[model samples]
Target: MNSLRLAAGAGPSGRALIELREVWKTYRMGKVEVHALRGVSLAVAEHEFLAVMGPSGSGKSTLMHLMGCLDLPTRGTILFDGADISSLKGSELAEIRGRQIGFVFQTFNLVHTLTALENVELPMIFQGAPRASRRARAVELLERVGLSDRLQHRPNELSGGEQQRVAIARALANDPKIVLCDEPTGNLDSAAGMRVLESLRDLNEEGRTVILVTHDAEAAGYARRRVQMRDGRMVEAAEEALR
Candidate 1:
């Protein structure tokens, strides 16, 4: 396998929170093999905000999924905090993901029936946190994301941006050390998108390692370091890649 390594050295000086060494992800579809990632290697430092920018089908989302432990690579090594987790079972991966990583997506994946506060508290509830502590943390996270007034609102009752903010708050429910956001602002207007991006930046500032996968240049600009990807491989620079 050809190796494409991008050393993420420009961010905050600290141990790498996640590392992907010569990772490959392949899928089988009706006897045809699709290689989503091609021996890509990367390291994300603790508290760094790194953006992976590419157009559609560039394997950015696949990369994010592997980093987030949502899926395992077909080949190569993945390490979380210096421990190899690439070969872990699904339940073991879920345990680490729940405790240490959070995810935000293009579509706000909030439950329609759950109030904002309730949604934010859901992760903690699953983690078996006490009800009182979960509620308090939910309130604090909602307030932090400037959604204090919308705690009682359901998804249908809030704006797209508000819903996204709620998703962000919910991602923080377990106080995850790493936040993986995939096209977080894809569904909102400029103003609302800016707010969501600002919230992400604030999280990074507060010592959370944030990895954002986006095709928008403006969104990628919020990150401390940017890496461009193309055709399932990391590239150095291409102005048109984000277009």
Candidate 2:
């Protein structure tokens, strides 16, 4: 696989929007202490598209959680837009996450009872946006993701690709600067997955920072830069190991 070579913790733009310095995450399962991340350090730039590739149990999801502000690191520093977020309170972290970061998942976690439009509007509602404004933004976002015709369809009414597109639209509802996607194409067929990947590429071209975590190299190809994780540590390349 072709890859870009750059200094560690630096992006094309030379400005780090998110930085993880000597980060470590450990989980305790009663009798055993599991280390999910081992002194990992990474930097994501303002509009960079980065892919984190790893096998199962490599701690890729744990890294995403930390980057998305969903959880805190057990040891080390996390900086968001030049602000150290490791010490931020839960409420403060939530506020930053709601306003500045968005997330997409492999499961396409949409509200089963809500229409596509309603699902897209959920984030704005959380931010206390006016109904009219949120609705308008949702419409724009859905259209942006090429879901203009399926606004009224529920998750079950749409195909896996369509539902994933709705999830992408919802992720953009709050106009977040950073989007974290964890195995977004895991459940789709090749064609559908390509379409979803294209949408993500478009979003990145439009200037939103995107971080994708996937084990599939095809998915990683959509990113401008790629990093590998192994046994809780970041490795420059692990293709041979993967094979």
Candidate 3:
């Protein structure tokens, strides 16, 4: 594993942490076929804060899924830390997802029956972390997200922002190198959305590779790099000029 680096800009310079080479993803529905990603090639440097923006059916979500290992590309190669994962089996991919990738979605997917702390602890539990370590780490993560006071609250009892914070904490449980967020603030009001964005920024600052998928320009502005997609293809891409 590479030693992680933290910075205010696009993070420390290193080998490509994520690389996609001519990737394509297609789906078949009845007699029709849908192409979600079309020959996409890209790379994300270690600790980069990348925003993937596209309209509906533009394939940004599919790109995110491919990068996060939730789904494999239909054709082409995907390398994570230089390891080709595009051809991995389901169990192999699941291991990668647990150890190297974290995911956040618009829907706060915290288990309704689990308290915030418990929810944050779930991933570590899956990783076979001991109970004491899991509890301690969960508390630390909740505090990192400014949700220490809401630890015992279930999803139904907390505000949307609080619940999202819990979800973020849960995603960080496995200490993944990459954090994939898909319209993470689409369900929140402006205030809550800002809080979530700030948390993601903080995570990026702390050396996590943050790949955000969203349609909102304001949300995309938080990232140091932006890639625009349309009709299943990348139309434009840019990185912030360093000061």
**Per-residue lDDT for 239 in model 2?**
27
Clashes of 3: 0
Determine the C-alpha RMSD for candidate 1 after optimal superposition of all C-alphas: 3.2
Put down candidate 3 lDDT per residue, 1-243, tens digits, no spaces: 011111112234757888887788999999899999888877888888999999988999899989988888889888988789966889898889998888898998888989999999988887899999999999999998999899999999999888888999999999999899999999999999999999999899999999999999999999988878898887776557541
Evaluate model 3: give its lDDT: 0.86
Clashes of each: 0, 0, 0
Per-prediction TM-score: 0.93, 0.93, 0.93
Can you give the lDDT of residue 128 in candidate 3? 93
Pairwise lDDT winner, candidates 2 and 3: 2
Cα lDDT tens digits, model 2, 67-139, are 9999999998989999999778998998998899989999999999999999999989989999999999999
Q: Name the best candidate (by lDDT).
A: 2
What are the clashing pairs of model 1?
Answer: none
Residue pairs in steric clash, candidate 2? none
Put down candidate 1 lDDT per residue, 1-243, tens digits, no spaces.
Answer: 223335444235667888888888999999999999988888888888889999999999999999999998899999988889876888899888888999998999999999999999888988999999999999999998988999999999999999999999999999999999999999999999999999999898898889999999999999888888888888763312221
Clash number for candidate 2:
0
Error of 2 at 236 (Å): 1.0
